[model samples]
Target: MTKTFVIDGKTIPFEDGQTIMQAASAAGVYITHLCHNPQFTPHGSCKLCTVNVNGRNCSACTFPASEGQNVTNISKELNEDREKITQMLFVEGNHFCPSCEKTGNCQLQAVAYHLNMTDNHFPHFFENREVDASHPDVMIDHNRCIFCTLCVRASEQVDGKNVFAISGRGIDKRLVVNSPSGLLKDSALDVSDCAAHICPTGAILIKRTGYSVPIGQRIYDHAHIDAVALASEGEAHDH
Candidate 1:
């Protein structure tokens, strides 16, 4: 039997194990999110997908959908809060969009545009992070990492290689390479691994592929993220 839930006045159906995010995406409802990929285990690390579930906030990605549940996903208050969170992501990282190679195709930038974020609402961290160019075919620009952990999960789950891990805690947290020398060159990651291409930001990039599609012709250039997601990655189901 299919369980149904109400989200922003729309009815969505889900299988027994499906999450709210999975169901909403299947039902063609666009929710603001950052750290969610249907291919990975729902980490619920990014709070952008938090929704009011019967007066309590829950992450849609990890929260299982229950029958007859009322989920407040989209609202003026919600969008405003989400916008602020997106702003903090911008300032906390050195995400100078103009200088970023993933400007047009970046999910963070697309989510910012979707939420109508205009200015950096908080003070910039300006912390100097490393740019790991030690790898022969891949580069790690730590300044652009949002700590989404897609790469870490993809490395372990998809590529069968434990090449990345998150270390430290809170503001001191950062992505670390799994190698004796703590560098990508010494790791087992290959250019063809799914982990290498799973980064949503410019943090992990293939060498010599910058601006190949040009600025105005990139993936998110001509389409809203929601539409693009639907067309390219519609109705995500577990494999």
Candidate 2:
């Protein structure tokens, strides 16, 4: 059955139980979002798609639409909030896109561009992180991780292997392999494992295909976050 709700000043009908993000994507009211792969479960850690639902800053990826509910995806308040979040992602880690392999195609970079973030307002954490190159097909750089948990969830849900898990306290939390060996290659992960392909950063790069796609053909090659946001709007119109 379909339910009626308000989104960005428009009253629209959506299927009951569908997430606000799904509903917005269906309606083409695009919000600047990353860390949400429709192919997998929503990991609202990015905070890029935070929308005001009945005055709460809830993530669209996980929030269900309700009858007569008001959902605001883009507003000054939300834009500022998301911008700060984007800034945090930049400074909290080392996101030097110019030197990284995933520069043009990264979702984190795209969202930053969409939010018009040219400089990080916060102090850089500059934490010392390690890279795991033990896996034959993939590399894991802990420094680039924003703790989105996409890889951890993907491993369990899509790859059918529970090889990744989160460990540690607050700011020091890290992704750990579920093996005594600790190394990714020693962790018994295959090339086809979701852990090899689900990362949004250069952190978990595939070993051999590093330069397969040229700079221009990358996912965000010609598009900025603003362009993506606009494209989402156009896509909504197609529905």
Tell me the alpha-carbon RMSD of every candidate: 1.2, 3.0
Q: Could you tell me how far off, in angstroms, the CA of residue 181 lies in candidate 2 after the best superposition?
A: 2.0
Winning model by lDDT? 1
> Can you give the lDDT of residue 31 in candidate 1?
76
lDDT of 1 by residue, 1-239 (tens): 76799998888988888899888888888778878888889899989998999999999999999999999998888889889888888888899889988889999999888887889889899999999999999999999998999999999999989999999999999999999999999999999999999888899999999878799998878778888775444635533
lDDT of each structure? 0.89, 0.80
Clashing pairs in 1: none
Q: How many clashing pairs in candidate 2?
A: 3
**lDDT by residue (tens digit), candidate 2, 1-239:** 66788888987678877788777767666777767766667878777888999988898888888898888877998999999998988888888888788888788887777777788999998888888998778888777888888888888888888888889867878989877889887776788777778787777888888779988788787766556655654454355
Segments of candidate 1 deviating more than 4 angstroms? none
